[model samples]
Target: MVYQTDLDAVLDFPILIGDIGGTNARFAIVVDSYAEPREFPVLFTADFPTIDDAIQSVLDQTSLLPRSTVLAVAGPVDGDEIDLTNSDWVVRPKQMMKTFGFGDVIVLNDFEAQALAVVALGEAHLEKIGGGSAETVGSRVVLGPGTGLGVAGLVHAQHTWIPLPGEGGHIDLGPRTERDYEIFPHLERIEGRISAEQVLCGRGLVNLYRAIAAADGKEAPFSDPAEITSAGLERSNPLATETLDLFVTYLGRVAGDLGLIFMSQGGVFLTGGIVQKIVPALRNGVFRAAFEDKAPHRTLMAEIPVYVITHPMAAVCGLGAYARTPGRFGVETAGRRWRAR
Candidate 1:
């Protein structure tokens, strides 16, 4: 529902916020407008029957009535139901409001919340991947490969920052090398197509390993992605190492393409579980080299900054920020050009 006044202004303090993903659901209570929030233990989505069940467990901790709640879900937020991309829980804002007796509830795409969090992150929360200093007056893009790939953009508009969210992971993944072309056909295609998500997510890690092994006519060990990553990181398997290398390289290429598409001179932020686990591989120059390999605009690519978000609760931080000041986020209005004040 649209609020008459800004929702941020009217919402009560100690707001409940969440970043719900395929594997885990993270929740926090913002007690003060500017203070660090009280967080709950990470809840696995598979353990809960519905989103309501998960929230109920959190409420059981304090037994207090919250003024409002904002949930950052790992999928598109549309119409009445917010269907999770990788989870079974279907979150309905209006239904949730009625069930919980909440004054308001806001649902956002997980990456949309991450895009908001970009403004809240400090130097300590960011690990630089490559590029020069971020542009102070340009767009910023944030994408993450976890259970799924998420893409979003943040831009200043009308004295506020607005989030641009889309399903960019579903786009066809283009190959840039002979090796990539050789392995493309082996990927477990989605809907008879090879989308970026099929090669950039947790399952995608396994897909890469299998395809690489098949191309070389060798048998792949470690049936799952975790085992493959373990073998790759432990330096026990050459095939696994090569698989991860290709994965990171392709990720860099996709990230660079996104940088160009959004003109994200401000920066490109990478988040989510998979990138966090494979950070060492990402910093070894392969990823950066591929990122800046763009023809003609390679110079521009080098100038655009890149970062990996180390903060785990970044989405929660952004949701809290929006909860405190709705009008400041520029999400309520549209088409207004922003100025740096």
Candidate 2:
């Protein structure tokens, strides 16, 4: 879908778009709307003590400073203080502006930015997971499991797009099967209270593996999600395979529930690093089955299209779009728009 926005408007100043997640921080510069975004080297979030450190590192290496910036963070955004849910990085927009002397700084929930990117995405950016055609006019939801589970929604109203961001990942995990029941108790005990994030993130992969192992009276020795995923995809380890299967199934169930809640007939997009790595597992029918398992609303669920965003610059595109036509995005910053310093 080609976004109907003017890219030239955003190029008046050197604009920096940062997609900061628990695992990685991706930076890009907006040269023109018709041109490809120039990206910086990927920075691991854990290596830096704070967001300021990471930004400074990028500045030091690139020898260029942005006149304005939009940072997409993996957490809730409220006021001037922002903290990442899965990483120990706190970002303060006011403090950052004082330190860097930028003209404007905008902070957004990572998935909120994802919601905006959904509109800017083209067919080449999306891969259909399941469902029939999208409703063309309604709500569209985007959720994904990565360093943590992120959820957001987008709706078109009065020829403008609005993004709804919330901590939907922290919702309670609902069990739907005998295996689910067996594992629920373990996850609850392990988390002190079982939230969806406890079992749907990178850490959640290991958590599921351990929970399944505990349920079957076996010991799970895996320490990393990558190790578990490798073992599962290869099918060399039965426990690992079961763990991945359970993860995909639960993901589908949660996605279905979200679709029904939002009535996301427009579409549901899965955006995250983890899903991109496990695309094969998502296509093996387990995910689709669980997604359509809504009893009375099976037909409604089938009508809601779902796709995975494969674009590396999804969130950046959203930030750039908002920069071009902030009013169309319905984002209120009290008239504080991006300007060259």
lDDT of each: 0.83, 0.81
Query: Compared with the true structure, what per-residue lDDT tens digits does model 2 show for residues 189-211?
Result: 43367888889999888888888
Ten contiguous residues with the weakest lDDT in model 1: 332-341
| Cα deviation of 57, candidate 1, in Å | 0.3
> How high a TM-score does candidate 1 get?
0.93
Best by TM-score: 1
On lDDT, the candidate that comes out on top is: 1
